[model samples]
Target: METSVFTRSIESLLDEDEYRALQTHLVENPESGSIIPGSGGIRKIRWGLKGRGKRGGARVVYFWAVRRDRILMLYA
Candidate 1:
């Protein structure tokens, strides 16, 4: 996980709709651990989604980049 990349992603810069979507995800699937691909020029990268609501239920996503360096991060 790249700190800079995770800190600077579209998911990191959640808009009104995106924030609601995340909250919905947390509510719906309260016990799932998964990783989904991130968007916006962040190929070769995947964001980790971990549920921490019920002793690791109800997930949150952390966007990450796969580059060797942190210069490629682009926050939306």
Candidate 2:
């Protein structure tokens, strides 16, 4: 996974455990997120906060680089 785009400020959006969970989920299912229309294959996944449900959670945007076998975490 290429998370260099996820800076300190971005990481702060979620706690350590939440971030780790996101990473694990992405690693296990990189193409599970819904693709964004007209974004050149970018995908988005909803991640719930510790107490909130998916509706009130953050939206993680990423791209699955199939050819490179990598996930490019873009935003959250």
Candidate 3:
């Protein structure tokens, strides 16, 4: 996984298992998130926290580069 300062900061807030699960989910379904308009194709997915349901989960913003098979996780 590629890491940026922003992403690393967000990752710091997640447990190891949560981070791994998120990585696996994105790899398995790159198009899982909804595209953000006017953002050059950035996408956002709502990920559930340990005890929180989807309604209270964190928002993960990312960009999926299909050609390179890379997921640029931007924010959380």
Name the candidate that leads on TM-score.
3
The residue pairs that clash in candidate 1, if any, are 30-58, 51-59
lDDT of 1 at 50: 43
What's the lDDT for candidate 3?
Answer: 0.85
Per-candidate RMSD, Å: 11.6, 1.7, 1.5
Runs with alpha carbons beyond 4 Å of true place in candidate 1:
1-12, 34-76
CA lDDT, every model vs. true structure: 0.39, 0.84, 0.85
Error of 1 at 63 (Å): 17
How would the candidate models be sorted by lDDT, starting from the highest? 3, 2, 1
Query: Per-residue lDDT tens digits of candidate 1, residues 1-76?
Result: 3245544555544555754665455345432324444544332222233432344322234333335322222322
Q: After superposition, which runs of candidate 3 have C-alpha atoms over 4 Å from their true positions?
A: 1-3
Q: Tens-digit lDDT track for model 2 on 30-49?
A: 98899999999999999988
**Prediction 2 global C-alpha lDDT:** 0.84
- Which stretches in model 2 have alpha-carbon errors above 4 Å? 1-5
Residue-wise C-alpha lDDT for candidate 3, range 1-76, written one tens digit per residue: 4557646766666788888899999999999999999998899999888788888888898899988889988888
Pairs that collide, model 3:
none
